[model samples]
Target: AQSVSQHNHHVILSEAASLELGCNYSYGGTVNLFWYVQYPGQHLQLLLKYFSGDPLVKGIKGFEAEFIKSKFSFNLRKPSVQWSDTAEYFCAVNPRLSGGYNKLIFGAGTRLAVHP
Candidate 1:
């Protein structure tokens, strides 16, 4: 079994401030990690994913994440955040299972509030 964790329950940032959201997961074998965002009243959406290829991947809205397999971490970063960036972010993992089905484990989301 695997679990996901997000260190911050809430974060506040001023416009143009840099942001980093910590995330960690416990899993083994080939795995896919992801970040998802949900605005106040919007559906959950994918921010970024790390299935393979480059460990550093870029995502929408100037978000990026680095996959560190050894540490089991996939922290999200945004160099400069804006007021519109306020949202709840969730980290999830899909560890490849020997069985045919794959399960997605999600972390308790971090709510980010960016002030103007």
Candidate 2:
């Protein structure tokens, strides 16, 4: 079955550190990529998303993701991260289906711990 993969299981960083989390999917067709973050005791929030326009999509909280179609990757990046950025980051992909309703497949998720 098609799935998403996050290379980093856990990442520890100090405040203002640069961050990059690798995310790859196993599908080769048209897709919509997304980055979701779930903070401690908080609901999931959309960090960034990529559809049909730009390959590089910017999302909330200073987070951005580049959709590399050739590599089948949509890696999330941040030039500087703050302690408040501590959360579980998940990479999700929605493969285009016949009926235009496809369930999102998410990665195992990368737990980010930012220290002050």
Candidate 3:
């Protein structure tokens, strides 16, 4: 079965601290990986995506992720985080199928708390 999983359900950090969230997916074939963030009272926004080219991809708001094929994982990382970064993070994937647009399968959710 194809699925996505986020290890951390919630996280707490102080301002200017580093952040890393674990994300793992189950898929044997080609897939598109993505990290989406949803701030308080806001719609989900794309943080980063790994499509075809490079394995390491960077996204908006100083977020980055490295796609490890062998591990079937694409973990998000930020060297420094702010209180404004507090939000919910969801790891998603689009599995390639026969036809039609691929649908995004997201993990449960991860709540990030950044203290000032």
User: What's the distance in Å from true for residue 51, model 2?
Assistant: 0.7
Q: What ranges in model 1 sit over 4 Å off?
A: 100-102
Instruction: Summarize candidate 2's per-residue lDDT along 51-113 as a digit string, tens digits.
Output: 898899989988989999999999999999999999999999999977898589999999999
Question: Which scores better on TM-score, 2 or 3?
Answer: 2
Clashing pairs in 2: none
Local lDDT at 52 for model 3: 84
Off by over 4 Å in 2: none
Model 2 TM-score on a 0 to 1 scale: 0.97
Task: Report how far residue 82 has shifted in candidate 3, in Å.
Answer: 0.6
Model 1 residue 47 distance off true place after TM-score fit, in angstroms: 0.7
Q: What TM-score would candidate 1 get against the native? A: 0.96
* Model 3, span 1-116: residue lDDT tens: 78999999999999999999999999898999999999999999989999988898999999999999999999999999999999999999998876858799999989999999
TM values, all candidates:
0.96, 0.97, 0.97
Give the least accurate 10-residue stretch of model 3, judged by summed lDDT.
Answer: 95-104
- lDDT, candidate 1, 1-116, per-residue tens: 68999999999999999999999998877889899999999999999999899999999999999999899899999999999999999999998887846578999999999999
